[model samples]
Target: MQQQRLPLALFLSLFGFACAGTARADAGSARLPDWRVSGFGTIGVAHAGEREADYTSSVMKANGTGATRSWSTDVDSRLGVQLDTTLARRWSAVLQVVSEQGLDNSYRPRIVWANVKYQATPELALRAGRIALPVFLIADYRKVGYAYPWLRPPVEGYNVMPVTSSDGVDATWRWSAGPVRNASQVFYGHSAVPLVDSLHLYARHGVGASNTSDWGALSVRVNVLRADITSNIGQDLFDAFDAFGPAGQALTARYAMDHKRMTLVNVGASYDPGTWFVMAEANRAISHSFLGATRSGYVSAGWRWNTLTPYVTWARVQAVGATLDPGLPTAALPPALAPMATALNAGLNSLLMRIPQQTSFAAGLRWDLRTNMALKVQVDRVTPHDGSTGTFINPTPRFVSERTSHVASVALDFVY
Candidate 1:
């Protein structure tokens, strides 16, 4: 993998040349050198109109923009950088990276957050290498698209659980309850990603808990997680249903994907109050292999008008358990293995149609143009149910699964 990212890019270029030689030896010192550096970016383009699938905003992307062409910048370009250091009295540290377009489509740069913290007092704090997986509610700035006003983040509620970061350890606490203010957290981690074809997705042990609260302009959040995942991305259709003996080993033990057991739950809320704003969230997921259950949500609203804002959103995802099953029957099979048991029950119900039902509606506009820039435009209008093909991607074969797609986007965000 590019020589393991060259030692995290030479340790972030030797910590940015030792924070630029401690700010040129504290140039006329007035105190301000404990280290800091920041960045964020996006320059995007998108278009889709269902050209037979391919409009992705993560499924760990492998292709995007209707039929993979017409228009796309891989759905959203990206760039990031960060650093924060203090490393002493109560310690502190962080490191970011980013550089988008992955799942082997390359734009490399990884390592999102390097972590190290400890401020064990005034309301606790603690961390360890690589963290961030709050599971939702802008999950730690959701890739900083100029700090949100949409052009993303509603892939049916952030694509269910696209997991972002995890290595191990976390702790947080913060207080105040009178006029509300809180920040609970707890974690333990493990993760591995890489999807699409060569597949990989592991999430071991991973534990979680989250909470957030505020009162002034209202805010709320809640989260829970569990893990013990594993993947083989359809090992040859569960080894052709384990060669059909005990009902093909009982359909590869009721839907393969090995070490299963996944669970997630989330809740969110927002309500700005400066001009206007609103947000909502919901989630649910359970697994018994083939990623069985699901339920997603989204809601957004905006209106600011000074530097433009205008927004709207409503999303959905639904597939609450079992999207088809019933394999290995082939009528008393024996007629020469009955066409290989009806082609392994039609390739395991066509891989359970990838379990995603959909609905989307969006509208956007954001202009902020300064103070770290922003500019956006959006449109969505998905729609896929029953014959699901929602999170589109590489369909073709005249792919028309309950057609209804329309995507449009434009972006230019920045931060520093």
Candidate 2:
């Protein structure tokens, strides 16, 4: 497995103490400490109908099904463990570790949350260290399958940007007025995320805020964030560009990925009253880099009848091209440099074209097997726009333009 050895021991120590509490409970039920340990996981199988490309939940993953394709366990299966306990009268900590398919296509455990929290009063609190980014409605608990009504979150919306956590400090304030309860959170942090095999992204000087309000069965949220972004483009491509002299320099300057600013905004609302529920959310991620701009959203509704619940979802991600020019003039360049200019323009267009433009419709049924477990089956029809591949990776020449792919998945989700 591709393990991040650093900080593994620190996370293990926190989990280790939680395990000791369990051991004490086994030895003497009354002697157990306040430490609590819990976990959630999904055993899933997925298949795709298209053979020219592989379908995946995230762009970071390298594995999926295609021509050599069949059912695979790597698509949605995952396991996570969390430890929560009090350190002092007003101080507490949380540690969470997860093992799932990642950028390296391995199940190695990674620390998801390792933070200390201090409660100053009933209405205010502070936290520091690695913490979840409140970038979406379910940002903090997106991995916990039992917490949501669907088999999985709409990939088009959730996969827009894969970095989920930041390393720094955050604070929350709570208040209530009449029948409405509200909480506001503000945070500042930095992060590094490995995307695919060649793109390693870094976010610096990041700051964000999230506000949520609840009234009866209705809940609403708004979030905004900004950060300075940088990424390591493929080394081979970098060298090729570097060799092209001023032309390459101009191309790199137009992209301006290093230290460029990125902004994200989100709005979401949901209403649930026991028997039925409806939800909708929208997000915009804009940047000056090659990552470009993405606008995504999803709407879902479900009706619960006894132990069975059926749901439907519609989601899509639309790519917005950048406004900057590549400095490749068609008529002004010399004869010797015409070929280079053409190549640069073509490369720029290819990068812009790769941004996803996909729409998907999904239907699923969830069966409550027990208090903490559920069985689910889902089917999705995904259609790409303008010859884009949507969420599919490793595209081949056989991939048909504007073709729709059908994907089916079955999963058992449980928590304890």
Candidate 3:
């Protein structure tokens, strides 16, 4: 069993008592105490049509359950709070906190960001404390779903890398050239997570940099980040799949996964002309390899008009050797269980050999039902790059058998 630890006591102790007393005494300090507090929420349910594939966690499947379900409807439903404070001349601070079903329904108030800033000059600023790496232009506003025209950011692309956040210090630089506005950031930090064996997650800590440019109708951002991920369990992901089946193995060798540091490169661009908006991004991640290092990427485009925007997305998830254990029974099983065993074995083999490449075709629509509130509907048809996505298409005892998951939802989001 994996045990998750929350380092909240430290944060709680400092959340209020540590506000710099001197900042309150400055000339315009009274204005600083005006707390602009806001609440944002999303109440949604998704239906996952996995056609009976067992799903242990929604985080891995589509929506929240991913695609390992026979039938599921809700993805990730969450809520959050934010505080924006202007602490005297050219200085400001922010804190955004959230609670969500993470790492197996372990709901905890994760401090998304807690930082202070001082604008030394209009174009330069210094900041310290925990901060989220603004890998994407929308990364900072991810919690504000109303700002986006999608029922959900395309999971096939947006979630390839966990939202990279860390305990560290960083700086920002903003400037403009002719019709282009530019901003750049550099940061360094240390990050870590808890739990291992049977269940675990690798949290890495390192330094990174990002830059963005806006030129009239064109906007672009490029980010480069490197971190020494701890790996799912400090074991070769492939070997772990084989030896770490649910039954648990004898537990052979275990070693930390390091790059020295894993590096990720991403580039994004968007074009808008009032009535239409088109956007896309491409990313590549490379790290050490026992089976051999791996690379993955995706491309997507969307269009918007008024409050109703419809999109067509096609994406492929490629893994050279990322397959884990298929949870299959050994061969030579009784006749009654042979069919089940065979299915498991095949799924396990493909996963182990990296034989499965997944392709998806999806269409979605988002409607701004009201100010700060919206409703969305989408449908996706998924096909395995090889074989039934590594498992037998079985009828889920608890849910109806469906080849595709149809999802629709209404949500209210506000920032005040």
Candidate numbers sorted by TM-score from highest down: 2, 3, 1
Taking the tens digit of each residue's C-alpha lDDT, what string does model 3 give over 1-416?
11112324433334344355435556464444556888777665555545344321122322243335433333546678888776556666777787665553455666777777777799998776667877765677766677766656655455455554676678889998888999999988766543323544444567789889988888898988887765443244335434435432311221225334567777878777656677777666655432223333445556777777786666555555444544445454467766755554454443344322345566777777777777766665655443323212222344332244434333444444
Give the Cα error of residue 395 in candidate 3, in Å: 13
lDDT tens readout by residue for model 2, 4-108: 443344445544654554565466544433688999999988998888888877676767765446787888889999998765445667888888888777787
lDDT of 2: 0.80
Where does candidate 2 stray beyond 4 Å?
1-33, 195-199, 235-239, 242-247, 323-344
Between candidates 1 and 3, which one is better according to lDDT? 1
Residue 174 local lDDT, model 3:
98
157: Cα error in model 2, Å: 0.8
RMSD of 1: 18.7
- lDDT per model vs. reference: 0.82, 0.80, 0.56
lDDT of 1 at 68: 71
| Model 2 residue pairs with clashes | none
lDDT of 3: 0.56
Every model's TM-score: 0.34, 0.88, 0.74
